[model samples]
Target: MRELYVKSLPLQDVIANLAEAFETTYFISCHEYRINVPEGYGSGFIRGINFSSGFGLIEYSCTFKESIKIHFSVNKIHPLKFIYCSEGIIKHRFEEKDSLHLIDQFQNVVVASTAQNGHILLFPSGQKIHMNSLEIARKDFKTKIDCDLHYVDKNLRKLFRDLNARNLFYYHGNYSLAMSECIDEIKNNTLLGFTRRLFLEGKANEILSLQINDFEDDQKAEPKRQILRKVEMTQIQKAAQILKSELANPLTIKDLATRVGTNPTKLQEGFRFTFGATVNNYLNKLRLEYARDQLMIGDLNISEIATNIGINNKSYFSRLFKSTYHLNPKDFSKQISKNVLLEKL
Candidate 1:
């Protein structure tokens, strides 16, 4: 993955000279906090690319003052922008249509243009706006309708609202704090690189699914059919409990399925649907938890600990331990011991 930062103002001159630049519009400025982008140009209006991978491109803009108008005209590229307002408000006029008024500390808007004619407006200062542009190729987009709709679908919007409501308890309704934590982790934590991105994408999809469910519920539509059978559910529960009890053992999905009297496919699907994680994922989590307890309480060498946890592959076990804890096993053990000594002091 590569990241690019571009902020050259006197953007008025850039806008005048660069006819090929793309212009996108956003009504809500608060959505900027949700984007992952590089920081540039302290106070003035700034534009830069945050991250670009095989997944897509994310561009950002942080503006302090509002000019009369700002224009970005690009080639034939369709990208989605998530805008966040840090301070004031912005009225957005799109395709010269009636202006859409949005105000608040934060908001998220997704925009895509097919042919031409796309524009946006920014209001007075005291507020800032951030933008993330995700580029989806037309060919790949057709193959992944579910992935595409995950961002702009109405159902996903409701899901975000619901999750935001829950997050209010965490951040006292300050969306910026919640968003900053996500972005900070994205920037600082190497372990979170791919998984964090995947998680964000999954959250977007879940939001979309929730919106669809809500719409169906509102119209009195029948619920989506579930694929899990009673037998499957029972087997999944059994396998999970067994895995929980035996975290030290080498566990395979096939072996778990056999023990639970089900096939591997059913076992995998049932565990995921019922527990929100695959069997191996759940098992690894369980092992990590047990390993933590052992590290804190037991006097054991790393190899001995790994053996006791049923991880006979010591090197693989060490890697998993470090990935889970962000510290090598010996270091983690030493840190725990240090904490214990401090408490005694």
Candidate 2:
């Protein structure tokens, strides 16, 4: 096993420590530090950035030839960490503990160590792991935020308000679809320079908000059934793909649920939680969006375009289109044609 000790903070030092352990160089661009895996270590890169708001982000996307352990052992109070595993599995344990907590794909955890107790991350050999950590220097963060946190969820207020590092806290749960989307945006965004920093800070805060909201909702749920699970999210993703592909052949919620290997009630809840819309409502929205694209392309008549998107009735499609876009389908198509002609001239 290869052991790496990272006694650093504020993201930049963390990256520097890792780069030194691997004996490779790192680069900083737009306030983000990134290091590519050297020839001997495996493939992929690790990058991180820190914002002035006392929040930072670190991303690990790599595979190792041998099992690796990263030990974070700063002398001062450790920052609060919100960790998400998007691919493969990541095992984490407090520096003083022996047992480990597994964070699988689509799962997240909020962790705060009491005092200076650090964190240990384990990455198994040959596993391609993708994980993101959002760290907040609590003492610094509390000072920047408004003093009144009464609006914060009761359960989270203590977690967020504990600036003295007096308590240890940990909560593990599945990532909400909204949070997952935000993570994707943060990872894949291509904005540059000042805009990139602004975008990342905004997304980091958005993700933190969503994580807090999910934690609150999870706490409020009955113990018998946590509102969302990783498996259910997978099923919902499958169902969404089915809806998009099989639009012409609509199915009842029950049938769709069965096809996706989940129950109707859970399916409904999943759709509502993930997309903020009922199943039919989501389908209708998808259909309308597709119809608008076809209309703009001017490849099919209104009836054909409607049918293509699973609406068989031309008049009904026109009403739905008008309701959504404030323009009838035919008129919208005409406008597209007129714009194309004018552009050509």
Candidate 3:
């Protein structure tokens, strides 16, 4: 096992420390510092970016060759941290504590240690870890012009107001689909320079909002009323995979739900939340997408394409395809053929 210590404040210093520790090069553009892991240590990169608003984002996407522990210790009060694990597992514990909290995929934790207690993160060997940390310097954040946090939940409001770090705070819950989508956008964004900075700042706040909401929703006593849990999401994704694989002979909603270990009502709710469509509608959309691919290939006629995608009614399939892509299937296929011929000529 290897240990790395980072004693720094703000993102830039942290990244510099990490680059030194990893013996790798880091690039900086518009205040964002990014470093790729060196050959001997691991694969992937670590990034840290901060905004004038006192909010910072650090992304750790890596697979270490050996177990590694990164300790974050600052001389002053540590910044509030909201940590989310999107892949693999990460173990976290306050500097002064002994027990470990495992943040599994789709799980998030909000932590604020007392005074300058600091934090420790453990990354297991050979596991792909993708985690994000949203840090806030409470004193700096409070001084911002738009720092009003009255709308926040009562407990969180208190946590936000605690600039002196008088109390230790920690909350754990499964993040929402909304939060997951925001993470995806943050990870996959292609914007550059100043525009990228603006985008990241906005996304940081958006993710903070989602994290707060997800935590509050998890506090509800009624499990049924609470937002979806990570386990529930697993079931939902399993159902979606089944839907895609068994399109030609898809199971009924109840049967599918049973197969995926969830109830039908919950399954429907999951579909609406994750895919923004009813199961039937989502299935039809998949069929249409598959039909479009077949149409482009040109080997299958409209009727065969429709049948292959599980829609036996050629007329209904044609109408659905047209409604989705703005052209009839037959006409779309002809257009593809015409384009190909023109290219050949």
Q: Please name the candidate that would achieve the greatest lDDT relative to the true structure.
A: 3
For candidate 2, lDDT tens digit of each residue in 54-153? 8898888899888889899887788999999988898999886778999998999899888878999999889999889999988778876657677777
Q: List ranges where model 3 is wrong by over 4 Å.
A: 144-148, 224-226, 229-231, 237-266, 273-276, 279-345
Q: How close is candidate 1 to the true structure, as a TM-score?
A: 0.34
Q: Per-residue alpha-carbon lDDT of model 3 for 69-166, expressed as tens digits?
A: 99998777999999989999999999989999999998899999999799999999999999999989988888762356777788888998898999
Candidate 3 lDDT score relative to the true structure: 0.87
Count: clashes, candidate 3: 0
| Model 1 CA deviation exceeding 4 Å by range | 1-226
**TM-score per candidate, chains pooled:** 0.34, 0.72, 0.74
User: Where in model 2 is the C-alpha error above 4 Å?
Assistant: 222-231, 237-278, 281-345
- Flag clash pairs in model 2: none
For model 3, what is the alpha-carbon lDDT of residue 267?
Answer: 83
**Model 1: how far is 318 from its true place, Å?**
1.6
Clashing residue pairs in candidate 3 are: none
Model 1: worst 10 consecutive residues (lDDT sum): 164-173
The order by descending TM-score is 3, 2, 1
